[model samples]
Target: IDMLHWMSRAALEMIGRSGLGYSFDSLDEGGKPHPYSVAIKQYLPTVSEFHFCREYVLPKLRQFLPPRVCRLALDFIPYKKLHKLRDVVDVMHQTSIEIFEAKKKAFEEGDRAVRAQLEEGKDIMSILIKANSEAAEGDRLSDEEVIAQVPFRTFTFAGTDTTSNALSRILLLLSTRPKVQDRLRAEIAEAISTYGEDMTYDELVSLPFLDAVCRETLRLYPPASLSSRVARRDVSVPLSTPIKGIDGRKMDSILVPEGTKVYVSILNANRDSTLWGPDSYEWKPERWLSPPPQVLTDARIPGVYSNLMTFFGGGRACIGFKFSQLEMKVVLSTLISQFRFSLSKEIEWKMTGVATPWVKGSSVPKLPLTVELLEAV
Candidate 1:
């Protein structure tokens, strides 16, 4: 089975219902990809092609020209990839507007109309709409702003690819380690036997070995390897220890000028041998079973979760990280308890903004794994 393909579809379906009270795919085998899904898949790659324009040309134009005028200029540029990006944005923007209008109409119609929608009006956008309607006029978001939130599209674009890639990575790892897979399966089976299959949030999160596996996977292979931020003010960032400067003088802090673009390397921080010891390069989920090395704790990496820089940190940290974890844990527990996954074909991972698995020699992302249905435990 091609794990990445199915994982992508599953991520879309999961976010569709929970984020927008909508459904993107039925997830049926051999089903066609949804139009929105195809566009979203194209979005990142298409945008990457315009990095030069975005970083230099667009910023320069924005200083003097209005957004609409800049858009018009882009339309006249006659670039193929630029046109493709415009189409992708159009689809996402239109879809978000449609969903927002439907949600607003439902909110005005009463509770019955709200309850008629999928998720029974419990999805993220539904709650946001309801709250916005009841808020003070000054606190309410404009229609354009609300639509721009694009809760569904944002989650699909941000969460889908990353979560699916992480899931694919974990499955690939599990496929190669039968003993580890069986141990994880056994842990999940025991939890289900004790708590029933419909495990609560607490029950799911409290599973030790399962948590270790996830934390380990994320620590070793963060979906997004880098995050960027612009310094808002001039400040000196203190180093953990003084290092010799280029002038042969000890430097305890480095001055960052305002507006300087800073790139934080999430992957390097997570797998640092100095902090995590020599085994940092190894994939050992068991390392998380106990307290991490004191050096790691003392280093004080400012990650949003579990002392790892996978989610970044501070004001711009990933907002949907907890949801992503719950989604993974739920999927892993259910799937691991019922099926066995083993390696099928050789695979290689490529960095395309996110680390994506592709079968060796193939241009497309694919992770072929042998899946077997397990008899009742």
Candidate 2:
């Protein structure tokens, strides 16, 4: 199987059911894929291609040209990527509109039906719709605002390709690292011996080794290697370690101009020797088993998930990080328990925003693994 594609479909269905209160039915091999799923798988790569400009260049354009004019100019240009991105956004907008209308009709069906919908799962759209319906007149979100939460677009994409690639990287690691693979599988098997054939939510969360492996994987191979933020106003940022200025004087702070675009180097920060020790670049899941050094612990980095910027920091941090972790753990445990994986060939990863595995000659994402089904543990 094309594991990257398979992982993408799985993530699409996951975000669909949990965030949109809808089902793409992607895993059903016989059913045709939902259009929204198709759009998302294509949309992400397009966004990544725009990153060359998104950080330093796009903000400059925004200063001179209004967003509307810029978009119109882009439409006029004969760039295939820009046009494809626009079409994808249109598809997402239309889908969100349809989903919003259906949920609104459900609300009109009476309180009981709405409650049933909520009970199915607190899918983001349902919660947003419900909150809007019950809020004071001044507090209610507009229909458009609520619809923007629809899956296969907006925040829900965090759980899609970004997550799929992260999981694939972990899988590739397990296939390549035999000792780590055996230890992880043993941990998974031992934990679920008394529970049943499958690992439960409680068991999945409590397994220490499993948690460490996931965390270490995330730290070493972050799904989003870089993030962009444009300054809204001139501000000074403090540094933990001061740098010397051009005049040969120590500089405690640096001024950032308004509208300046800054790219946060997530991968570099995660692998920094100052924080994670000199061996940080190496993939060693066992590092989590011990306490981190004091110098590392004392310097508090404010990232949302753990101390790493794998999911970023602040208000705009990934909303579905815990959800993604749950999916990864469950998928890893399930897959490893039933099969043995061995690397079939060299797999090169390409960072099109979310890093994905690619072979030298193939455009498609492919990571070949020799798989053998194992008898029940």
Candidate 3:
């Protein structure tokens, strides 16, 4: 049950350091939580509760309401969720501003140490700030826009929650399916025997079984279930099989008009019986070992990762797909090599912001696993 929280905290630390140059001290050095960490942790679930606002209302509000007016309304609102969200946003904005100011100061004062950190594209936030300033006049963002862009550096929700939830799913599956877990560990053990446990990026990525496991996991349990898209213009979508309409007419394609909302079902697509054959709904890592069927490949279902809708498709696809995959692979390899996990109790998975798995009736996210030390594969 506790592993979920530990995994979430570990993910928070990983993204905090990788996405930006900040440390949440979430792993090991724990005490009273970092104020930002507390705020950010509470943020997603709160925002998820108000999804209607985010999807349908907030965009409109932002379009219509000025910043001053928005702030005034926030100040006057007595709602609990709104208050929590506002506090989280305040923390994010303040922390980003501080980071931005510190970087600005270091650059202005010509601190060689800070300058060295900025060199060779080591720090993403610094690079972005520098690039924004050096860009052409037309390409340059306004000061307000540039400042506002700081929140995206760490990418608070997506970077932490997305990877964490995906990882949680992977761990839960491994715990329940011991044979599959053993096979994965055996594969890692062989690699460790040759590479001495310090597997390079190339070696980690090259492991076929490991790759298959990740692909299967992501395919079965995507981070996001439904991704909504708004059609920019009237368009027709090609379908592999014709469907009879309500009017009793067979339709091969459906017309999508401009401004129409299209909700892409990532879960259904990944588990589609037609595309992936009868075993599509089953969690079989070996399925990926074979070459993809022509029928599946020929359909040209657009996606960013593994031809699966787990990461969605096209230009707006997940940017951190590789990073998330690497994190999962690394974490799994390290953990499975040392510990064996078995289910402690039944878990109920809820389809929410991150589709968390928790013990029944428990408010907190949890997956109880009886972990034991593994002497060898």
Judging by TM-score against the true structure, name the best candidate. Answer: 1
Which of 1 and 2 is the better model by lDDT? 1
lDDT of 2: 0.81
* Predictions in order: lDDT: 0.86, 0.81, 0.79
Candidate 2 worst ten-residue window by lDDT: 148-157
Clashing pairs in 1: none
TM-score of 1: 0.94
The prediction achieving the highest lDDT against the true structure is 1
What lDDT score goes with residue 131 in model 3? 81
Q: Candidate 3's residue-wise lDDT over 1-377, tens digit each?
A: 36777677777677667666667764764554566666665676777889778788878899999977988798788897798888888897787677678876786688888766766445566677678767998998765576655345436557677777777888888888889998988899889998888999999988888889889988998878888888999999977889999999999999999999999999999998888999999999899999987778987889977779988888788777888888888888888889988888888988766788889889876777888997764
Tens digits of per-residue lDDT for model 1 on 1-377?
A: 88888888888888888888888898888788787777776777678788788888889988999999977776888788888999998887787788778768766766575645533477888777877877999999988877667475456679988998899999999999999999999999999999999999999999999999999999999998988899999999999889999999999999999999999999999999999899898999999899989988889899899999998889878778998999899889988999999998899987777888989998777899999999874
Report the lDDT of model 1 for residue 150.
42
Clashes of each: 0, 0, 1
Where does the lowest 10-residue lDDT sum fall in candidate 1? Answer: 111-120
Error of 1 at 343 (Å): 1.9
Off by over 4 Å in 2: 30-32, 51-77, 109-115, 150-152, 197-200
Better of 2 and 3 by lDDT: 2
